[model samples]
Target: MWENLDRPPLDGRALTRALVDGPRGSWSRVDVVARTGSTNADLLAVADTAADRTALIADVQDAGRGRHSRSFTAPARSQVIVSALVKLPGVPPGSVGWLPLLTGVAVVDVLRTVAEVDAVLKWPNDVLVRGDESSGYAGGKVAGILVEVASTHPVVTAVSGVGINVSLTEAELPVPTATSLQLAGAAVIDRGTVVRAFLRAMGSALDEWRESGWDTAPIAELYRSRCDTLGRRVRVTMPGDTELVGVATDIDEHGRVVIVPESGDTSPVAVSAGDVTHLRALDA
Candidate 1:
């Protein structure tokens, strides 16, 4: 149903109207850019001035970025790059840190509903396809999320950016371990449908976050149930010269990965920023 659109760089005005026409609580505003350096970069630059719940969708990004400055590549017509602006109220500065994880939950919900694939969250923020890891297939990194905070007068704006490999083919993937919807047998997907579903899911999540005192338990529970990182051997690389190798015990209340070392000592490490690598035991 959503495939009837002509192509990328779609008319923003028309798309916005169509999305709003569907439901009353959809995105407040939708702006489509033909091309940009990065939707996150563009949105963050004006987040302070933009109205809350505004979204930016881009067809192509010349400098699209992933967590830790990793390059995110997708063919101009095969990916979805979107950034939504959220304003949080009554949430402490420390507690607002879970926005990225919350956003990832919203994304995985939409992916499961539309694609009907068992998608799992990789701790902190990454989506993985279940069962793909054990079958010698690419199991990790189907999508990535980045949330940037901009604080100004009377408000803290979170710019949530998402990169989804929608219609990308196997040959177009940046790495062998990475896959797209098409490669995962979601060939009938329509980009607009995916975007609309994502926005709706995000709106619901944000509303609940604001109402629930930023209590991350509900979202965390959902994340943990769908997360593949828990109880796995992992190596977390920090920004400085610090690294931890342990078994992921649990996701703490603050969205930190709780790790237990091989020495039989339990230490809950709060990872605000880092790369988590899931390791396989030599015998496994």
Candidate 2:
């Protein structure tokens, strides 16, 4: 861990004090570990009995995952990997779908405020920076969010995991389309600061979402405004290999992306789940 001079280890003690003891204390508990297979999976294991706002962060994730069970990993201390358990006793089932979107917005907010990365949302779960043509970066993905339903009987408990690349170099990226704060020229790259800001931002957003009766209108609007996918020609790949090419028009009340098919014969469709690929930008 000391070998990577540029990548400093997170101050777990400071984090626990600020996030758990500070006036703006939003998390009930925060646990930091040196290594974990997956924070989300580990948190889910205790979600049934853990406190409502418990949080878990790992310095290095050996088997981190994203949407659709895609696996990824980063060098030690090169990313902020965290998972939080949020228990919503009365949240509507449909409203639960927006959890991942809410998480994406929180990540973008933290990256912009703390990292100063000029980040934006890529629909359902990705946070990205506008690629620089000169740098040959085709809008790399800097962070990913994954939300899983931990329980639904007694209460709607959700375990949301987020992974933000902090100081990964070009060669360290898991994929060609992936990027890090260092690669994106962020002003700050402290994992602890990023994690703190993200937790606070997430707590605030979740509070608003709950106060709004899981209305989703306000959250949807906020997400749409920051979403780069809304005004673009996109190709969506749904389950079972179904495909739809269209222009993203809006985010509906249920938090689905409304896609207006390029074909004149088909009507607009609101997709709840799929992989969206941005083909080109379009005027909203």
Candidate 3:
């Protein structure tokens, strides 16, 4: 019996044990920390030595970061801040780009099924739900995924980080275009369950990807299915103030977003990295 002496954050012992107790278990271990600057940074620091499939979940993130080095922080204990180390010893470099997409799928699944919340994905890494978009914030951000590849020589290791707002109330939202599971009226708000589902889904997706010779078709198909970015007008902001306004068409095999731009370029532009803002609904 685990007793919370003083509003315990999460029971690491029980969570880790439950992660591997059932047949669907995918993680080797799940470690919970009271507070950390960033779970991704901590995992990446030891990814070289850490066992594959080890996950680090934090109850408090003081200096979390998101894509493009943007600072990401939330009220402590209100979000799920977690990271896992994945070792792709012989996987093709071409397939590494799918990590974030795969993570997005896992999250969407967990949100919809385990948490009973309708979730959508912004291209590349943002997790979104319907909300106000007037502030250049399309669909409220409910979660995010960040995948960092540490090496390629000896073995390829990627630290996949995920942050999901679980219990944050309306008043606690980081931004107007942001929300939490509670705000969305989730049927269940168990952080442990969400983390477990994410790990299992990711592990299953990774297996399918590797078994297919890093073939991205399966993941891409599924990702596209859940992606809200596709089939919508969008603005992709590149470095140096470059921008492309287009209709997100597809996620190409290489994991780049293929968009039919409103610009004169008839060919679909494949974007590998940039800030994406979903624009108004495409004309019917």
Candidate 4:
């Protein structure tokens, strides 16, 4: 376990004490495993019985998946990989789509404060940092979030998986467009600390969301303020291999990215799910 001196194992007991046992904590349970295929899949497997607010972390994820089943893998202890089981009650079905966006907002806030990195959100739920021109790269994907519905028999439950690169070096990055906290010049790189802060931030955001009756206004405003894709020209690859190139104009009430096509139509299109590629920045 200690073969890599720099990449030490996570202290599960400490995490449980700080996040699950604290007075202001909202977690129902926290589990840390040495190796897992994917924490999100593990939680979904038990979604039928897993308690709400349950958090699962894996030191090494062999088959981590991003949006569209894109493989996201890293060296052991190289990232903060976790999944939280969230059960939403009294939330309207239409408003449920905001869960992932809300999660992104919470995570971006945590990264900005805890890691001390200039973090921002991209469209649906990607956390990114401003790229350094000297580094020969535009802003890279520092973290990616995947939200999957678990069940609806009794209530609306979903498993949200968030993977944040922490200690990966430039050569270790999964892709040239991917980056880690260390590579992003984070002030702190401790996995346990980052995980604890992320949980707290997420819990608080969920509480606010519920209190607002799943209202999208409050969170939407904040998300828009931090979103970098709002005024950029983007190419969205929709289902069926179709493509739409337009300017991202707004985030609708349903949390979809509102796009104004460059031509062929004047009406705006709202995209709920798709791959978004930022083409260029437009004048605000």
lDDT (tens digit, per residue) of candidate 3 on 1-284:
32433224777887777776656777877899989998999988988788888899998998888987889777667788889898887888878888899889889988888887769888989888765446432347899888988777688899999999988877888788788887776787777777777878878877877788777788889999999999989998988879898899999888899989786976889999899888776632
**lDDT by residue for model 2 over 72-184, one digit each (tens)?**
98899999999999998789887898899989989998888888877999988999988888977665899999999998988999999999988898889988988899888
State how far residue 22 of model 3 sits from its true place (Å).
4.5
Ranking by lDDT: 4, 2, 3, 1
Q: Please state every model's RMSD to the true fold in angstroms.
A: 3.2, 2.2, 3.7, 2.1
- The whole-model lDDT of each prediction reads 0.78, 0.89, 0.83, 0.90
What's the TM-score of every candidate structure?
Answer: 0.90, 0.95, 0.91, 0.95
Q: What lDDT score is found at residue 79 in candidate 4? A: 95
Q: For model 2, where is the 10-residue window of minimal lDDT? A: 275-284
Candidate 4, 142-188: lDDT as tens digits: 99999999876679999999999999998999888888899888999
Q: For candidate 4, which ten residues in a row score worst on lDDT?
A: 275-284
Clashes of 1: 0
Total backbone collisions for each predicted model = 0, 0, 0, 0
For model 3, the superposed segments whose C-alpha errors exceed 4 Å read 1-8, 131-139, 281-284
Error of 3 at 51 (Å): 0.7
